[model samples]
Target: VDTFFGDTISMVVIMTCCVVGIIVNVFILVIGYLDWATRKKLPNCYMIVSCLSSSRLLLQGTVLYSTLCQGTHHWNVLRVQSALLVLSSTACLWFAACLSAFYCVKIATFTQRHFLLMKLRISGMVPYLLLGSMLVSLISSVPFIWTDFSVHLCNSTRSSVKNTTGDSTVGNISYFKVFILYLTWMTIPLLFFTASSTLLIASLWRHTKQMRRNMTGFKDLSTQVHSNAIKTLISFLVLYFCSFVAEILLGIPSCLAKSRWKHSICSFIVAVCPSIHSILLIFFNVRLKQTFKGILLSMRGRILSPFVLSFVLIIN
Candidate 1:
């Protein structure tokens, strides 16, 4: 009874995070679409944001579905769901790395000939990079069709099977393969993300120092931009690191995998990363921030108008 209650509470928390993430991501997509419809052109950065949000949306939905269907005996259902989850999660990281690379090329004060040349071509390369990310994610997820998550589930639920050496050996080998594949895909984007983000942050810090030397005010526009960008990059770095840790925890074959509550906690960590990061993106983006504020004011006005009218009628 106690275990069931704990599992229920964990599921609630996971569901809440997933649902909130889905809503935020949907808002980002809608805003991106509306902006494109009005301006007839979406910038490369905006395009990347939209793609990231889309992947997060898919990932959150898959997580919700996986949580809901955790008890079903259908291995095929679990197989496809796991594949979709991995594909979306991989795409999320790749898109994030692309976004980081884009910001680095666009904003960082790099003067090398190669850096300048890459900057000139980066806009043209965005579509190709995005396409490559999708292809990679798809390729990484396809191997899941042959993998059986049910085997792990069964082992976790049964104690007698746990003592079998042959089964443990087979399970270890299978888990190692999955871990290797997941780590391979994860590491590719992580490398790009780390390099680009570090470069951007370093460049911005130098620029900020130069601005200070010029007797610029703390509130100077350039200084503010640099500061905000640094903050965003740092926050993203932390979230990415957390996501990496969570993925490692999930991928590793260990006793933690057998614990229902521990698994749920890891899932929550994974789910919260994209959601919180999306909110950060919205706050850091001027256009999105303005639009979001306008939305809130409009909502507040609507909610209060009826009360104001009722008070006016009473006075009359």
Candidate 2:
């Protein structure tokens, strides 16, 4: 896999991925927030959407800092992940779980108590909760960030450097705590997400089947919207599932043993999913695709000479 421009290509891809992920997720958040604001009285669904978008997007920063800041000791905290990624990811889980619960109640119980619904909506509270969780995550990761891990300024090859894990005992404990959080917070919630969504889908399937052939009218539109929302959520879930696997493949072994290359590869992979989602959304999303095409057209002057020359070269 290591070839000419290997590291260069990988770094570019990683950085590009971060940039795209941040942009797309931020775009999603902005859309969600705009939707919430447009309706004056924010609905529970919009609130949950806003929360999910913001939390997922914020993860872009965590991954970005972690990926770009590699091969360093001083600012190892953001690069390495501590409480930041964990807590943010966890909060995302809670928010999604809330969404799932809201849907379940909406579908099953079918409530119409508008006043009670207003009180139940958590959009207003999301910002404070996010801010608090973020602070906790960052503060907790300090110990996890390799302090003594330093490299000589003379070395041109940054990846070849090693992390000088400072104070073995404290580091070990930090790692253990991270492990616990992984089990209790990250892994558990991921599993919960799968289970809860699975159950909801199953129930929905049974209900639809009971109602005979197919759905129509406003019920159909409502069902379609719900399905669309679920599909979007599924996208996030699939990405996170892959992330969990990558975390194991890249993180566990090194945390248990001592291998920098493996850890480095793992770190790179960790940042991949968020970026992948961004690129997919930008390229495939109808609106985003149109916008991207517009930008390309606007910049066609700069791109054309090189493009035409490359085309001529290929033809010749």
Number of clashing pairs per prediction, in order: 0, 4
TM-score of each: 0.88, 0.63
lDDT tens per residue, model 1, 63-181: 88888877654556656886897899899889989999998999898899999999999999999999999999999888776674534554544532232323221212254577589
- Candidate 1 lDDT at 174 equals 58
Q: How many pairs of residues in model 1 come into backbone collision?
A: 0
Best by TM-score: 1
Candidate No. with top lDDT: 1
lDDT by residue (tens digit), candidate 2, 163-201: 444523223233444555455555655676677566557
The local distance difference test score of each candidate is 0.81, 0.55
RMSD of each: 6.0, 7.7
lDDT of 2 at 111: 39
